[model samples]
Target: MIENDCSDLFVQNFSFWKHLTDTEKQFLCDNTAPVHYFKGTNVHNGNSDCIGVLLIKSGQLRTYMLSEDGRDITLYRLFGGDVCILSASCVLDAITFDVFIDAEEDTDVLLINSAAFRQLADQNIYVKCFGYQLTAARFSDVMWAMQQILFMGADKRLAIFLSDEISKSGSNEIKMTHEQIARYMGSAREVVSRMLKYFSEEGIVELYRGGIRIIDKKKLHSLI
Candidate 1:
């Protein structure tokens, strides 16, 4: 029988699981396992690792890529309850780009074996639909990120990022180093520092040794 221990959390996001037969459910449970990651851990590298689907049960994860010179840019992020299929690159022939997965906070993940998942998909219509939907969702996220980089000005993008962070934390100040900000924005630390200095002079933000405080959301919005 399929283990029911984590079914509540698992089913909350994968409701189609309820449609499976006992044998199918048991098969999945047998091939699946739970994994935990501490904040800042690299869950998957864009290397030779056989990627598999991950369902986040708690905390957050980031999907990003490294550039030729080693700078990084975030592609998309997955929060609790999000399903990740791009990580299952072996079964999906269309995934041409490389990305890395990392935990943004302490996290819980349910790992499904890629080969097993492909087998299930081949046998179950619901599983096929779920897989297709997941692929479409992740592709949309990637396209959105590409648009943000190609069309949005760097200052505007940074301002929007800071504004969103401030709103998320319900505080004007956020803890982040220039290096961290540079990694997210896919720029150099010096470039990020210079931009922050410009924003400070413009009365949009204040920078300290370890973090930044937004001073004017209106001005930041105006930049965009």
Candidate 2:
């Protein structure tokens, strides 16, 4: 069984939490549970599940929407120390689209109950500040994604995405499937495959089964 001791995490996430009364502190700690997700697992469904608040402890998650034809389009990715409220659309009332959260890597999160969080937000100034800040931050991110999709071409977007991956992993090699890339970029599998083939012919990238390696970073940058 996994240990649920997140008292330390609570303090680490909100240093001002130490100023609250012992009763309040204990209540928050007791309600803040730990959840672990294996790679490729769906952590939340905005259509059905009511996610309270998920504070990532480690690893990565992808929040995305599914099209009418079942194509998955990634909205944003979350990492450690990030607070996610879009998963709990039931509580927010502003979210209209169905978003699914899937674990891209093995992940651990601090899960707070929605009702408890609401109460805490109402009673504690620090909690309220954190909640509002998180909401605004997520909203900005969604807006940025909308702008990108609306203004940027797929080829340019794909180049930028690969550049980001290269910078993050510190290597030209990217271990991702064409299907996966399609989902991330909100494009069709056939389209992504065709685009990648074009990139390969142009010497922008070297393709392999289940992966791609950047050969000419300069060419990719120019496209973006």
Candidate 3:
């Protein structure tokens, strides 16, 4: 049986876990431990030794890569219910890459040791399937983001980001700054500010001191 604490944290939103047999849940519960990190803390850094997988329980996290010249490329954002396979390449091929992870906000996660996770994947069909699904989804998202950067201009990308935020929060008022948006879009803050000004002029969105309010969702979608 899954422990109440484990069920409450890692397995709550993991639908694939429901397909696992009782013995599988028991095995995982025995092997995993919960961890917490405060905002602005490094969960893991680029070039660190490969250790384990992380399943987010609450709050936000960011994965980024730093260039030799010291530029950050926002790689992926993790929210509640998301799982990050921190070192898949190293785990499989015995090599590592420069990929850093940090808590975007105060966060909680369940850390499943690599050996136990591998054993579970080997023995549990549901675990294998879940792994495949998560990998495929991550790959697809990266590809889509790359395609947007190649074919779409900064204005369109920023507009789409605002619209997405509106949809996510169920309100036009999004509680993030232009700098944060620029980080997510992999562009300059000045570029985002200029685009927002253009958007405001075009009646697509309204900029406030602390947040942005979407004025025309349909127009933003059309630009995207």
Candidate 4:
């Protein structure tokens, strides 16, 4: 069940919420469902499941794509207070490819049913505009990821990733395994291991079990 506060917050996240008619609001509330996902859960599997618009209440979600060879690359992530409209691409005419959503950690999400949302979007200009704006922003994120993979070298990418992680967590220590890092980088575990080994050898970082700590921020930035 959606808690009172969470339900309110979910409704409020929609910029058009205030403009909604009483009947429209009631329909939205009726179609929206609260769901919890355990860590590593596949919230949406490619284009196979149209789970609808997800309003994250807590935890993180990783959006990625899989290759035919069984490799996957992280596209972007949604955190608390973020709304994800890509999962409902089935209802939107713009989205063409498959995308996957996974819970990076245990998560709580308020899911607005796709059909209901599509109906709302069709009837309300404000809701449609909001969806378009969100979809554009997410596509920008996807393009950035693609640019990095296509143009940036692994060493530079890893350095930037570590730097960004430190900035986000406000800590030099990053608690993630090589496999996890590789998944984010769209590379193999061995590649990440070798890269980390090189970083350790150069005293740029210290790699311990399940984590890496930046030892030389200057040197790390130099690579980037």
Q: Number of the top candidate by TM-score? A: 4
Q: Which residue ranges in model 3 land beyond 4 Å of their true spot?
A: 7-25, 87-89, 94-98, 119-133
Model 4 has an lDDT value of 0.88
- The lDDT-based order of candidates, best leading, equals 4, 1, 2, 3
Clash totals, every prediction: 0, 0, 0, 0
In order of appearance, the predictions have TM-scores of 0.90, 0.88, 0.80, 0.92
Candidate 4, residues 133-190, lDDT tens digits: the string is 8999999999998887889888888898899889988999999999989999887789
Q: Is candidate 1 or candidate 2 better by lDDT?
A: 1
User: Which 10-residue window of candidate 2 scores lowest in summed lDDT?
Assistant: 1-10
Weakest lDDT window of 10 consecutive positions for candidate 4: 1-10
Per-residue lDDT for 69-135 in model 1, tens only?
7778898889888988877766666667668888999999999988888888888878877877888
lDDT per residue (tens digit) for residues 71-112 in model 3: 776767888888887543344332335577889889988887
The digit string of per-residue lDDT tens for model 2 on 1-224 reads 22236666666776457766777777777777889999999988757887688889998999887767777778889999887777665555445656888999999998888877777767887777776677788778778777767788878878888998999889989999988887788877887889899999999999988899999999999998
- Per-model CA lDDT versus the true structure: 0.83, 0.81, 0.77, 0.88
lDDT of 2 at 58: 92
Looking at model 4, residue 157 earns an lDDT score of 84
For model 2, name the residue pairs that clash: none
CA RMSD of each candidate after superposition: 1.9, 3.1, 3.2, 2.3
